[model samples]
Target: MIAKSNEARCTSCHAGYGWKGNDFDFTDQTGVDCLVCHEQTGTYKKFPAGAGNPAPREMVFPGNGKTYHPPDWNKVAQSVGRPTRNNCGTCHFFGGGGDGVKHGDLDSSLMKPNKMLDVHMGTDGQNFDCVRCHSTTLHNIAGRVYTTPAYEHRKSLIEDDLASKITCESCHSSSPHKEDAKANDHTDKVACQSCHVPRFARVNPTKMWWDWSQAGKKKNGKPYKVKGELERPEYDTLKGDMKWAKDVVPEYYWYNGSIEHLTVKDVIDPGKDVVINRPVGDKDDIHSRIFPFKVHRGKQPYDKVNKTLVVPHLFPKGPADADAYWKTFDWGKAIAFGMDYTGLPYSGEYDFVETSYVFPITHMVAPKDNVVACKECHAHEGGRLAKLTGFYMPGRDNFRALDTLGWIVVIGALLGVVLHGLGRVFTANGRKEQ
Candidate 1:
């Protein structure tokens, strides 16, 4: 709960004011930090731990020693305009503690992308802002990830009654391929992102793994971090072992837009990998289509006896919060404190469980030339969609009886053509002799 622990390290971005506790009024318009989204001055920044409020005065942040200065209210207020890529990315790009950590497709790189990175958002291309497609009306932005339909029925804006919510069909109609009729036929079975996006984390490395079991390790009585690829942390004493990846190929799945999340009270099977959140759809589902996803795998604390995932108070309240896992480096104390605060029943026994979370890849739109090739998914060996079975694909699938019968018919047709040509030559020679 926000009333306890340092979860504001994660929640502050979603909360609009000093929402460090539950008592923070959600209905109060005075608490809204409009500058976060509207200010064009390019100076406003939310303090990482300030519960959504900008620093009241100049101060230096601890550890990183980054200096924070209060914004010039008059300058920022006068400069307020429509939100740009920078405005939306302030929180989204830095989700899950750092840039490109949560959503592999979204990052600061998109703020000023090149044509190869994103055709729409590229500074050198269409130069469209995030609000261009995600049109806002009365604070409700179009294209909410989880709430959106898996596939849009509308062909274009002409037929779309749900004008406020945008999809690929909003601009690029269902049959977008003018040249390739085969690609157009794929619309009913495959998502646009499954082909257009191709890969995510193109510009930056995204976090792929986090093992909480490896946390609390220290060197010489002091916690430290070990940097790995791209100078990113592979191991942090405060968190755990981490794995990051760049230009990652996505896992294909049948998603119908619905997602099932594992709650704290939900029972789980320790024998299997616990899916933290999964897209709800199957091959037989009419609404489902083959979509791309960044599947993040990790290990996290769970109640062994209750068979439920447990939340650990990882972030500290301040420098000397003994109950916090980051400060004390004690799992027992941290889990106990967190479980107690949440009013969840927790047995004394705890263990780490393998978990997976799925993130749909939609951003980092490549140019038409860079879209996923037909061979990538339609090949017989090692295809991208090889894992998704129960469907007949042209080049990817084969039926032994059908293949044999087709080859026989082709051979018979060739023999018939040769014999007819020879008979015609013989008849011409006999006529000449007569």
Candidate 2:
């Protein structure tokens, strides 16, 4: 037992990374002693790093240890403090491009112990914890050799399955750019960020940190910041309540064209008179927009059934006026579905598939720069926009267009008097000539 005290536990007990282990034998105490890991010169030489920390109980951890007693478990747990990315970053983060740590994040600042609160909202907003989006469950976030899908939602099935990427999809709405496409020709994703964001840029839910040293120096050193501006999206005010993060990137949009509905058109020929070159088929992909999906606090792998975040009236700003809105009308839209309508005569090579059936490409428009009210889209009167046609004269916005019409009518009446006088002069001259 005395000799065991000198030697520490083997790799197995250390849990490889000092987290927890399956066969943890504190008694085995292999490899190195507690003093070594604790940074002590000898037995009983350890003290807490911070000033004024009370001297720890003069005992060693029990169970596997050969000597000494463990600290009061409850006292330690209470003082454990909030978890932070720093704990993970100590080993995971590397900016200078060395030691297999390349998430391509342009940040070099080291993580701080209690800084989580500053990065994300506290346990009162929709997003309570910062770790909800940054880290993973079951520990040590897993990633492939060539990491892809910079964020979880945009990640493909090729990287992580639908489940692992669920968090990404939830926050970033997955619906069509438009809500009810059949009613209002909403095109690409309206959340906007989904479209306009540079391929892999993401916001830091933890802390907004960047590496001044490596930021400007490109891989080839030709002024890396010279890269074109990262197109950030802009979000509209929520029912005149609040605005979203100013840095969000929206989609690239432009009017493709117009169509009443998205469906397939039928083509007909009688008695095989027309040599059928193309086959007719089906378009089955159909999507819909059900706004305000349920969102709870936390990050990746969001549990849909039961969970919620702490949303305050305001803190970073002030307590929220009311509880968090929780759901979002943004990012809700429909998609096209496809199907096979034609029964082909042959099996494989000669099998016919429909080319005409598609989500009428004519209706798919891109997001444009200039924003106009939905009413402005149609110029028809008695429509939503036309009904807005009221007095629209700009006089400190004091006068309406209809107001100007009233003034014009009054001036016309006065002009009639002068015209009558001129007519009398002409009539008198005509009588003299007679």
Candidate 3:
């Protein structure tokens, strides 16, 4: 299943490159095709089932007595040029099965976004591409995932000089707010994206919840699907129950540029929702800063005897393969096949366990004017930063002694001014009468 998933699903994005086996051979010269991204003519095509190889010229359409011919490869290769937004977005925009399914901030709407949606990538503005921030050197991309940030300069100083640098501070210094001192002061405690990206999935909705436990449910012995809000599939026989949301307000948390990922071998507590991937940080850590995140929750299969999460082989190798879960809807056979591939023991007993993963919100940056207002985070009630601890905010937090001292000074100054005004008026009247 792992081999099929990687070769079939994963290879769809890099269809121009060639792969001989399940494992990607980095040493193989034919595996990396430069024209996939650089091809501007859009003539290059890949065979979806051929493990990243080009489609055959005389491919026959299944069940249709029709023939399809791909473009000339030599001519397509000659027209190769620099990559564009469409070339890079081909895979990223449609990640996690569909558009806006995985990352809330990235989607097909960014292809020609307006300035209001994203200042940097907007066609009316800077019109920057993914490479602007995620610069590459010899095919090594600079930026890192939110789970494992490599460019957080304030946290965990990287000792490797060869490592790529792509933090917001790399272009805009740590003190970016030159005009507003108050805004600059918050930079130490808050991330630039926390305020800049007010909300995500503005143009489209993103999947927030998935329930594999509800899978294999059939209505009248046939696989069925139900649509929910926005006409999205709420349930499917192939996948499972899902919940999607749009214009989502991100959950805030502190991050120190590190994360802990739960592997297949790790034991989990069935009593609680397992954190598949968690960012490492704390409020007291000086290197940590408040960043926005999208928390994706789901329920997946777990082994009762092994006390670990199980990896089920869902795809079938052939039409008659009984071990495939999608084909047979038999959890026992699927789990056994997966466990055997991993060389791990699996108990027949299995149950769905709650799990969650966090993805940091770093894209969909709105213009400067669209940033969060000061009152949004500092309000006395229902403030965005109210849940955050280890710091004192003047309007949000109150100290009895400090409040009393401030009131006394204000009252004393007012009383002195009133008395001086009265005395001056009385002396002026007396001088006029004399």
Best by TM-score: 1
Q: How well does model 3 score by local distance difference test? A: 0.77
lDDT tens readout by residue for model 1, 202-297: 998999998989988889998999999676899998879999999999999998876777788899998999998888788888778788999999
lDDT of each: 0.83, 0.25, 0.77
**Backbone clash pairs in model 1 (N, Cα, C under 3 Å; residues 3+ apart or in different chains), count:** 0
> Candidate 1 has what TM-score?
0.88
Please give the range of 10 consecutive residues that has the lowest summed lDDT in model 1: 1-10
What would the per-residue lDDT of candidate 3 be over residues 1-434, giving only the tens digit for each residue? 13333344456574425655446664665566676677877766555444555567767533123554676877887888767777777667777657777788888889899988888889998998878777789786776664566565542114444434466666666777867778888888788989999989888788899898888999899788898876688998877999999888888888877777887789999999999988788888888889988888999899987789887887665578799787889888888887776677788889989998888888889999898888888788887777787778877888779889999999999999999989889898478777
Clashing pairs in 3: none
lDDT of 2 by residue, 231-303 (tens): 2111112111111121212112211111122112223222222221111111221221111101111111111
* Candidate number with the higher TM-score (1 or 3): 1
Instruction: Tell me which of candidates 1 and 2 scores higher on TM-score.
Output: 1
Candidate 1 lDDT score at position 143: 70
Q: What residue runs in model 1 are displaced by over 4 Å at the alpha carbon? A: 1-4, 25-32, 147-155, 400-434
